[model samples]
Target: MMPLSIYFLAPSLDLACFLAKLYICCCIKYVVVLRSYSLCLFVFLLQPVEKLKKMDLSYSEHLIQIPNLCGAINLESINLQGCISLVQIPSCFKNLDKLELLDLSDCENLKDGMENLPLNIRELKLCRTAIEVLPSSVRFLLGLLDLDMSGCNKLKDGIENLPSNLKELRLCGTAIQVVPSSIGCLMGLSHLDLYNCEKLESLPKSIWTLKSLEWLDLSNCPNLIELEDCTSSSLRYLKISGCTGLRSIIALPPSLTCLDANNCTSLEEISSWWTPTVQDYDPQVQHQNNKSEGEIYNFEQCLKLGHDTCINVIEDGARRRILSALDVYLYLYLFLSLRKI
Candidate 1:
């Protein structure tokens, strides 16, 4: 056989070129494979973005407008809280069939031009906005349970045709002078907050129909003078503080656990049938309308003084002792009279 070195030298350059081309081809194939793998991985990770069901864009200064969020068919909640620059909610929002919660609290620039929210929304907060009126389309929110519109200073018009299924409604800090009688239609309402509505003078007689109402706050409604016809049997908490014009409380329900009338100086009389457990009874203050010295009487003390005297009595340890003796005498007299009969 010929020597191995002699045969190897004859085809050395040809073999080198062939080997170089083969190595280059392998390097190109590896680069292609890596690029394809990276692209596939990226696509896999981004697939779930389409499945997003909840979004919160609060305090994001760059978010000046709401995009077409209707594509998110399964979206259940959207919170844009404190997005002060947001001026309006897109009209397409009505297309969100599954939306349940929509919070736009403190969106001060959101004006009255926006209209028609989705009917499926169960909770909504639009506090501290410029909204002046609610559109008639609001009646379409059949499933709404909680609606808060507090601090909408420009809101002077009354809400018409609210949903009957509403459970909690807050209209505090508005300029509304009257609440619509249509509010009586909300049979399921349990909590109503109308605090600081200074211009509100009277409540509709229909308010007596809220049989399911448990809490009612009418504090700081200075213009409110009469509640003779409005009474709710289910109300457990009632606050009428700062109602300086109110002179009487009539037809008070016995179910009340808390009654706050601390600053209502014009209240000259409390009915015999309605007596609340006393928490703080201060006697130094005088009545607002009359210069006569006023007194604070608790449930037990009121019974001893009788309805007429209770109005003049004040809270003092000495006065309480005297009232107790009077009560004993009255009871003894009643007992003797029954025996003689």
Candidate 2:
């Protein structure tokens, strides 16, 4: 074989001119590859910056990963949402102290949450990823506020000892049967959305003590049997729709403004907090006031309260009734006004 440099230096007009220069550059000391992997050859490096910030790589399907993001120590937000081919993150991700938001949602190839992350990370989203376990090191992220891990079907059990300062946590559509007891310590938690968690059977009793919680969504949790009576002073909205296994709902806190309990097929009991006088009332009042109560409680398709399918109504003088999502409100208001009789 002829020498490689002599073959390339045989200058044709367009092609040979570029190849000869590449050969000379390769011959020099420019390429500093440590362990040249025969499979793929690309040394991607970030341009040096005084203060790099905000990398929004959303919907980049082919981008596998970024190497050693710690090189840019001032990076604040790294949005890698819907990066389908991304398998793993760089090892030095934890060194970036200013990283506040890290969105890795819809990265299907990621198996587990990386072992270490920036301690100041405020918002971490892993929705629809293949994460099987949340690494124990997550406790050290003291500044974390929002953590959204919805649609991680592989996570049968998530992490414990989450940051106490966390505000919002969304764990919708996972296989987890129970939430970690350590989560009860998140006193500052404002929004806890567990939508469509079909396997969740119960919640930690300590959840009721979350004084700062505002919105709690447990919609479509068919296996959820009950909720601890909520005492949160800040709780405003609650959703328990499609929870067929729920046997009863305890008396709600005074602060609760909205409650959605639709499609609770097996709900056999309900708490009594309707009457201002705290006296028992009748369900017949629902039909009497149906015309005026449309805005408050519309019972367009409610199974008649006297029907055999009506299992049991709010635990009192009223007979049991298997009402759908809409009709629950009708009976509530009707019974409340019945106290006037």
Candidate 3:
């Protein structure tokens, strides 16, 4: 009853519609697969990209080694503080030429004989480490601005050359007996902390050249005998405590705001010659426990005795004891200030 042409056309129409729906479905599936692949690639790439921004693995219990760090070329800062088990920093650290800050504070077991660090590093902290004697190559860190080597007790020598751009340098709790005169070369230095350097006897006269210095801490330097002809127009804060042998502090700069000489026993008298408009003069002077008759000169009377006659005719033995006590108090104050920072 139906025409053959109609019948054939009906079958063709249905087949055409079915084929179009199948093609569309395949295209949608292909698109979905492609988008899923793109997302996976994005996630993989984003992981490393995110890591480049900041890396603070300090005290991370499981992070023992820094193996993956080699690929973090864009890393600018790395904080490894309190990483107790991290015994070694990868020598591949030189590969991170882009790194600007590196904090290895309290890495007690990290003693891999690292004498030289990368030159490009701007800030380096080696607090509470056992590395002794910074390599001569340390001068190559021309970009360094801040360096902390506090509590490195075995560090005895080899600090002749430091970077000229250095702004802050701390050598606290070290056994450094002598500081090289070359330290004066760092004209940009603003803060220098040499607290608890017990063996240091004399500072180079060249130290007077630090015109940009603002703060200087020479606390607990038991053997330090004198600070001769030192002048710093920019110096504002000075601490010279516990220096048992410190006989005199000469030519204080006019810009000083705080001068702490709390326990300098050997310091017979503050120089009356170079007067400055100081904001705070904490002469925390305390008389020795065992005072001798001649050494027990009244404080007000001693002030009028003129610089040359103060402490005159006092037995050398008694003078030594008083001087030692004064030095101890002075250094104690200095140590406290350094700790505050």
TM-scores, each model vs. reference: 0.66, 0.69, 0.64
Give the per-residue lDDT digits (tens) of candidate 3, residues 251-304: 555344445554666776545333222222223312312332332222232222
lDDT of 2 by residue, 234-297 (tens): 4556787777777776655444445566676666554544232212222343232232222211
> How accurate locally, in lDDT, is each candidate?
0.62, 0.62, 0.60
Worst-scoring 10-residue span by lDDT in model 2: 32-41
Q: In candidate 2, residue 54 scores what lDDT?
A: 60
lDDT of 1 by residue, 202-296 (tens): 88877767878867889888888777644335565678877777766665653444466657766766543432222211122111112313222
Ranking by TM-score: 2, 1, 3
lDDT of 1 at 225: 78
Q: Which stretches of candidate 2 lie over 4 Å from their true place?
A: 1-43, 231-233, 272-341
Using alpha carbons, what is the TM-score of model 3? 0.64
- CA shift at 22, candidate 2, in angstroms? 15
Q: In terms of TM-score, which candidate is strongest? A: 2
* Model 2 residue 142 CA deviation in Å: 0.7
Candidate 1 deviant stretches above 4 angstroms: 1-49, 271-341
Q: Pick the candidate with the highest lDDT.
A: 2
